[model samples]
Target: MVVALFNLVSALAGCVLLVVAGGDSVGMPNEWLARTPFPSWAWPGLILGVIVGGTQLVALIAQRRRYVLAWGPHAASGLVMMIWIFVEIAPLLVWSPLHGVYFLTELVQTVLAVLALGAWPQPFFARMPRRSRTGVGNTTDTPA
Candidate 1:
């Protein structure tokens, strides 16, 4: 839910960026794109809203729906967010506190997904009986 909200806000922000970029390029300066391969923030805004935002939103939905490999999307979305931030700063050649905030957020998102996916010794799914032939249950010897 947190990731979904983040993505939603990002998408809205991106859309706002698109609208602003398409217009007078108000708060955002065209000079920022001078070092990059863009004439304006229009393309970046679109990519943010569509690609970054879209992928995260889809991941959130997949998680909610209990889709198979939902964690994959969650992880992927985090990667996208991190990558977007990296690319965003590369051309600008400057840093902002918000970048650190967002980068950390996405990193946490990815870590949480990995933990939820049982990156540690916790079971991701229900355990079978102790004496089961498959022997895929938890290793702890404590009695149920």
Candidate 2:
């Protein structure tokens, strides 16, 4: 649910950036995208944002293992947000108006991490949990 919302917002934000930011952060040449309507350079970053967000959302919904929630979109978002929170050196570093995007990304990332680490099926929402590997939940353990 959280990932989905984030992805949706990300996709929309991409559109906004593409249209508003122009070619400043698009990442691709205006001639490449061939859609003069948008700024052009902003395509790379904006497109990437959309792809990551969109895929993350799909991953969240399509997977059965609870771990995916942690490693999939949630993890991706968290990683990017974490970096943005610290570095603030992303492509859009030049854009002042959208600089707030970093904080917003960080927020979603934090939320997802909390859900996976504290909520999910137990440790490793995206990756595997330690207990599951040690067989602690099974009855094959020796009593101390």
Candidate 3:
């Protein structure tokens, strides 16, 4: 449920970014992207939202729960993206005192994905049990 909710939000956030970039550039300002005449972050956020958010929403809705492949290497992928804007390309190469709406939304999406996989080791990220030839679920222990 949480994953799905975040996914939906990400998609909507992405759409908002595209709209603001094209129609209301002044609504949200980011010193990093403002350096360029073109609103560079919007396009990438739009793309990420469509791809990552769309599939995650669908998978969660269908209860497929393909966490490992859902986001194409999952949280690692999100981390990589956040790094580009928050680290390498971002001014001062450190955390910004204030982040734009787009950056915050993406950061939320990334945090959500990582938290789900890391929590409880099962509840949010429950995996199907594998069966052994004996017709019982696989266990960590072996008959001694």
Clashing pairs in 1: none
Model 2 lDDT-worst window of ten: 85-94
Error of 2 at 75 (Å): 1.8
Stretches of candidate 3 exceeding 4 Å from the true structure: 20-26, 30-42, 51-55, 58-144
Deviation (Å) of 27 in candidate 3:
3.8
Q: Which numbered prediction scores highest in lDDT against the true structure?
A: 1
Error of 1 at 142 (Å): 12
Query: Candidate 1 local accuracy as lDDT?
Result: 0.78
Instruction: Quote the positional error of residue 52 for candidate 3 in Å.
Output: 4.5
| Tens-place lDDT digits, model 2, residues 55-112 | 5565455444565444455656555544543443343233453446645655665576
What TM-score does model 3 achieve against the real structure? 0.38
In the order shown, what is each candidate's alpha-carbon RMSD?
5.2, 9.0, 8.2
- The model with the greatest TM-score is 1
User: Which order, best to worst by lDDT?
Assistant: 1, 3, 2
In model 3, what is the error at residue 106, expressed in angstroms? Answer: 8.2
